[model samples]
Target: MPLRSTRVAIGALAAAAMLATAVPASADDGGRQRHVNHVLLLSVDGLHQQDLAWWISHHPGSALARLADNGIDYSNAKTTFPSDSFPGMVAQVTGGSPKTTGIYYDDSYNRALLPAGTTNCATAKPGTEVTYFEQLDKNLNSIDAGQGLTGLPGSILSMTGSPEQVIDSAQLPVDPKTCQPLYPHQYLKVNTVFEVARAHNLVTAWSDKHPAYDLLQGPSGNGIQDLFTPEINSRADAAGDDWTQANSLTQQYDGYKAQAVLNQIDGYDHSRSVKLGTPAIFGMNFQSVSTGQKLPTSDGQPGGYLADGVTPGPVLADALSFVDQQIGRFIAELKKHGLWDDTDIIVSAKHGQSPTVPAQLTRIPDGPIIDALNKAWNNAGHSGTLVSFSIDDDGMLMWLSDRSPTATGFAKSFLAGYSGNGNDINGKPKPFISAGLATIRAGAQAAAMIGVPVTDSRVPDLIGIAQKGVVYTAGTSKIAEHGGDADTDRDVPILISGTGFNRSRTVDQPVATTQIAPTILHLLGLDPNELQAVRTEHTLVLPTVG
Candidate 1:
């Protein structure tokens, strides 16, 4: 395929340089010769810098420790706030926050979009909830995503990177302007590092929890040539196993994706059945750690940290060990293929689990909050539901049916005085505070924080910030949640290891994961400015590494 016109001249130059050079290396700090032919970007979801430091300190001989021994570990790396997985992952690849990405969470509201099945865009009122998570799957219940093939996991493994096959377009929100369903990639407002790599003709691949991760494909919709997404929310067994319900089950689920990375390292596709060559840019996200940090065992063993809130409990420790072992496998396979010297490994997290301290956890049902708003709006003679769409985890984001300032102010005022008794995940009664309205953002305040204009339809009219230890789910399935402004939700680990890094070094300088996008392109001998988000946000490469 030909390169995009904007990069055609640079692509030709790069092509000619590759023909003339014999495995040349890019020079970094202290005259380090970095022969980075491949970049392995791994997101160990829910991994915090503290967790990584504790694990490495406890296990000096571990693979992660070994990588850190030769890596530059950024001691303070923050992810995007309202830190849901979608926005967090998009921030890393696009070098932009929710402001520029036009994505807040997997489930958000888009005022410019029509209903999923709305056939007539011209006449219908434009506004609908955007659900890009597992709902888009062909079969949310099947691990294979119900591709309708003979084999079980193998069928999902052999997918030809066609997201359309796994995703049901009819379920997606329709673009009123085009009267067509908008895929995850089309929902994105900026280009990604994967798109930049493809512009340079480099092969790319990524494995994650859901097919909805096709959002990483960027606006071009073909950034990743080999995208393997096995649904993590699908049943783990025919007996109806939920992967996220248990730490052990989550580990078992993550193994499939770990094996896919190994297959890619072995010069085959995700299935290990076809020789597609190792991707220049490839990686996967592990969900075990995230699961362990939030869920307890089926037998009632607790998850999260020990009493100190810093040490990983038995469940979390096991989860961390599983991921470390998988990392060891990746390093081993890379070495076995004689590609270790040419590969750079960047490890980070999409988002971190909040309220590491189990004792601080307080569960509250989000239903009452929405119910109060809806009732008040109806009582005031407003038509339809007051809150059009809302997705609450540790935080509450509400898109109103009537987005007027009067409606927003009325909702905010109600929440400011809202108080009730709720039950914990264990069904123990607890008192609920007024949704922490002191820190909450509404109207223009909410828009400013999101980096969007107040009139932008995508911006939430009111963002209710839950208390530090408050979780919105009343279910006993999880003790903690993400998508909040807590330090535990946004503070994550960022490790740039492999060939070029000279020695073990921990820098205390604060950085954001968005810098990873530009840094990856810079390390791979591609122009960082080629990424639209990087240019729009003026994102710089990671300090020291770049």
Candidate 2:
């Protein structure tokens, strides 16, 4: 669909909703009065809390430090489960967990949706119903018609890359019958925050690394398929330049997205001031260090570049510096446009990455575990590996088929015999399964044997911990990976700043990525209790509104 017509239609729909209710604002309404006029949501992928602290303490005058000094810092922010891009991003936006949002990982198991006997990552889809920003738009529209005020903008801009790439990778081989993308946005069962914003006649914009902008263009019958505005921008492509240098590439992409946002803020019709609002919300996803997979850099490796064994190479350090500069520029532009004082800026990350582990270090052999398990299951007349297996950060989760009664039991028994025990890598005492079990009690015992923390809902049903220098692989170049039961994969930084925020206050309370959406909503004077995505008990205290 043409991007122009898409925007026009969205604008017209919002205008019509506004005109339909030419009523005066009321004070006694159940909905809280909108206190926040502008919100800027920024997501920096692969950012750890230590990285933030290091930037603040070591790199004075850095953009991050400025924000930290002026904002409230939540030191214990974390991603809920399978700490990968898709799940982490969904958790951040939806304010929900995998169990509720249904976005468990970059690729998740969906047996009923796909053909039987599928085990590959390329064949997965949303196993349950989910919802995203599109739904949020619809709700916002409902609010506009019901209330006198203009609704919020439900637009989303992301640089995380294409949802299509993620969906395609999750599925097995494409089914010859359907001949369509296996995992589409239609699979999401709930509404996203952006959807709510747009329904209220607010302008939304996004800039990111992926084609996410294009995928989520408009509401139903509006424009883009994903219910986002404009769909996407082509600025992420670097002409004749490799994206491996973290500093160089991050600076370029961040500057590009930041400029796009500034453009909208500049063009906004602020003359009407209180009459017609400008772009209400803007978000950007900066992806550069992730490209480090193709670059020759290490987290703590020596011999490249270092001071006192801390190898802060040009690749890593430069990228950090570049992103910091872009952030400073973004803030400057906001101030130039006279929106800095009123706008609330949030800086956070989707997830953090651990250093790469070379394949030669461990020398583990390629095993026939999948084939053996499949053959064993078929021979047992149990419909062939009913539980699809995939390796996650720290362990392997076996997604069982709803139809298979003994699938869980079969998985428990099959995983019991693996040689690598959980505690071997970390010196922490953890159980190692030597063979499979026949009962649920035995399954529990098996899990305990492997040192897998049972309370973390995000942990895979079956767990495996790689030795310190060892990383499991499908023989690909993605040497550095996450999704493990390790500290490096779980820790992320959350920085909240701007407009009624208490500056320089550090809170050490444990907060997960899932808490962010609700926090933002609450800060904006929206009742987060209305959204099913928010946990009932998780509430963020914001600066009081008059």
Candidate 3:
């Protein structure tokens, strides 16, 4: 592994303002060091090392092949623990862990949140979880308000789905016990690289699945210059584009947003008229791979049967091809614009999907577990806050009712007795949770298995990892899931290419995505330590660069 001598060219936030006056590309220390001014960060929701291998073994002439040949490849790159999308993405940008970012998953129970939004909290629906996948604010406020580039190449149109979860710290119904504001972003204890870049007046732009991703904005303002997202949950189609085509609607959504990156590369944004020129940092996440992970063969060629030893079916192949083609286009556009040399492109994924082997699919329903917990909470006669549940692929996140210790104890006991089978010790297989009560434990033991801290605020009071070869689902979604410590869930493809480095190199040393934030800053000749989270975490920048 090689190390680059990194220094903070901008001493302080104030220095950032002073230097902000310069154009997109600037020199470091009176031109003593060459700098890569532009950085395009692209994330595939569920890209895995295996997927890349499949592409190489299948499509020999893929853009992926070109990238691997041109830049440094981290053959062993892992995402943050829990491996959920929210935490995975944050790991790259915040250079921190779930504990540092306080983002465990997109869907996790936060009793700290105002139990309910504008709606009421009821037993049937535990309102404790602050779903980061929000499309609209609790007030139904549109997410399009000034979220995109002010001036546009085209108007940043209003998006469908929920809007940015508008937060007026003053308005949130504070938790009576904690009396703490329940805003999601507020929970992110540390800042992201996005904010650090902005501190020096660097322009950054990003497009994700939803406005709720405003979390990337970090606590401090100045994260993105232009942020564009179409409500991911919406079924609406872009004009003249039929989502019903071979392209999965989800793939279509991802492709649509990827086009935004194309526009940004071309010196503008979805705000067609606003001349963004080229942002210092910009990129978008692609969901095509994720969509392919779950697409069943019944769905057709675009539908894939991707599992261990399984060459991608037609659908999976199509998905990979689509992504490869897009990457080629991105590279070509950068070259055409002549910004290719000044820009560094990092193609990676937030996390990997699980159970690549179809035989490993184990669908364990949550009905029994939920029923037992609810009943126990009722028996405890405590605050009676119903426990909230989040099933992350194979891992389970259970936020026990915010009641007395009695309620939690009872819930735990019931879980302990559960066996997905009838009895814990040796009972008959439970009906719904056939593998239920498989392994019920918490604290460090549970966290150790999944690689998350039991003490993490975002961690659930009770985490359930189904029995080996078991998953928590009823065969509705994809075959393999993520969010657990499964190798299939953690190993992701990491490629650092484009203008800065020469000749491709492969580093087998394991690197965490946490290093990417600092790596970006380091490439641009900024002090990697300026990113407090990475600095505080003692994260190192990636090895070898321009």
For each candidate in turn, the TM-score is: 0.92, 0.64, 0.79
The per-model lDDT (C-alpha) reads 0.78, 0.45, 0.61
Give the alpha carbon lDDT tens digit for every residue of 84-162 in model 2.
5556666666566555555544434343354323455354652421112222221222212112223211212221222
Kindly list the per-residue Cα lDDT of model 1 for residues 1-546, writing each as its tens digit.
Answer: 110000101011100000000011122333233548799999999899999999999999999999999888988888887688888888888888777788788777788889898898889998887878788998887776767656765456765466667898889999988999999999999999888888888888899888888899988899998888887887766667667766777888889889889999988878788787888889999998898887745336678888788999888998999999999999999999899988899999988887788777777767666777677778988777777767677777777777778888988888888888765645688787785333667788788877778899788887777677777764455677788877888789999997667688887777888888878877787777998887877777777783
Question: Per-residue lDDT for 118-220 in model 3, tens only?
Answer: 3433222323545455423333222233244332213334332122334333434345445554454555778877787788887778888666677787776
Once superposed on the true structure, which residue ranges of model 2 sit more than 4 Å away at CA? Answer: 1-34, 114-183, 212-256, 267-278, 293-295, 298-311, 355-369, 375-394, 400-407, 420-470, 474-479, 535-546
Model 1: pairs clashing at backbone N, Cα or C within 3 Å: none
In model 1, what lDDT does residue 401 have?
A: 74
TM-score of 3: 0.79
Sliding window of 10 residues with minimal summed lDDT for model 1: 14-23
Q: Judging by TM-score against the true structure, name the best candidate.
A: 1
Worst 10 residues of 2 by lDDT: 14-23
Arrange candidates, best TM-score first. 1, 3, 2
What shift in Å separates residue 415 of candidate 2 from its native position after superposition?
A: 3.4
Residue 120, model 2: Cα distance from true site in angstroms: 23
lDDT of 3 at 170: 40
Evaluated at residue 99, the lDDT of candidate 2 is: 53
